[model samples]
Target: MTSSSIAEQVSTFNEGFTAQIGPELSAVFDAEQQALTAAGRPDDAVGVGDQLVDATLLTPEGAEVSLATVVGEGPAVLVFYRGAWCPYCNLTLKTYQEQLLPTLRDRGVGLVAISPQTPEGSELATSNGSLDFPVLSDPGNVLSRALGIVTEPTAEARAAHTQLGFDVADSNADSTGDIPFPTVLVVDGDGRVVFADVHVDYTTRTEVDEVVAALDLLP
Candidate 1:
């Protein structure tokens, strides 16, 4: 198959797979939300000074790296997601790559994307999405859990995933299982999170223009 055909096939497969798994995913998400609410953690609580913690991520080629190193001398935009397996994430990242990255760069901002997927998967995401920014691998969701954003998949969700032929193990070799919900955080030079959006609903995402406006407000 041609590259375009291969990409199309992947896209089609992902779409059908996501649809097949949606009900189980939704159930897990709902249960997690209820648990967090019971635990007094609001869905909208992602923010600054959250301190991403002792998390070491890898570049697409497997080099050890940290978000601190990527956030030098400028404001940084960190896009965190489960993996490239999510279509919503794929679209969101592609939109940022095609639109927001240049606009942010022009305004002296740096863009980086983080996920629980391996470097190989990250590389596939970057290449498939045409992302210019670095895609970092969070391995075991250590960074995600540190930020209080990790959500474990229910057994039903896991079974659904398996049925759909969605291999979390294959996609994120370092991760023990499924990924966290999609999140975005804007951090200033001092490592303070100036802006954050922890999406409860997988289909919804923060807009690029809204991010630009947030960046505009920073010093």
Candidate 2:
């Protein structure tokens, strides 16, 4: 378990990455984040009181399962991430495995992480993080788009990705760069969202304490 908070971990990674990529490329990423911030949160993003929309998702093994089935008859914490290729996503998921999973399990709440990546990519995420929760693939961004949380990297970012030696589309099942804004939603057994937190910036994440606070509000 990492002792550092997600924000601190992200800051450390950002500093190292910036140093590796140099100022010019780092500026490109900075501009991209600024653009996303300027765009603001999606108006139609599903929020508290909204019912969860059912969608078919793939397990890391490639077996299809419905979102409701994954959550079963209990409340759940649904995490929407970019992909396994994202360092920030990996860090956040790993932290959840260490810090949040025990609390969620103790309360009988399910935890599922979803992304528009291939089952292979999902497998890597699960294995890399040593995650106990279900890591599902949302091929084609179907579920994420339904939640109105889809976004893609800017052209400059894509070029930066090329320079970084990998393309987001390559890891995605949809073969596209589209991804969800990093989001966390707490939904009741009946599928009504009790709490929702969406981060326009990929570097930020919903902390374990925040989820526990939301759970405390549940009936």
What CA RMSD would you report for each candidate?
5.8, 0.7
Task: Give a tens-digit lDDT track for model 2, residues 1-219.
Answer: 686889889999999999999998999989999999999899999898999999999998999999989999999999999998899999999999998999999999999999999999999999989998999999999999999999999999999999999999999998999999999999998999999999998878998889999998677
- How many backbone clashes are present in model 1? 0
Q: Which ten residues in a row have the lowest lDDT in candidate 1?
A: 1-10
Model 2 earns a TM-score of 0.98
Name model 1 segments beyond 4 Å from true: 1-45, 49-54
Number of the top candidate by TM-score? 2
Q: List where candidate 2 sits over 4 angstroms from the true fold.
A: none
- For each candidate, give its TM-score against the true structure: 0.79, 0.98
lDDT string for model 1 (44-63, tens) is 45676664454678999999
Clashing pairs in 1: none
Q: For every model in order, what is the number of clashing pairs? A: 0, 0
Model 1 Cα shift for residue 201 (angstroms): 1.6
Which candidate should be chosen as best, given lDDT against the real structure?
2
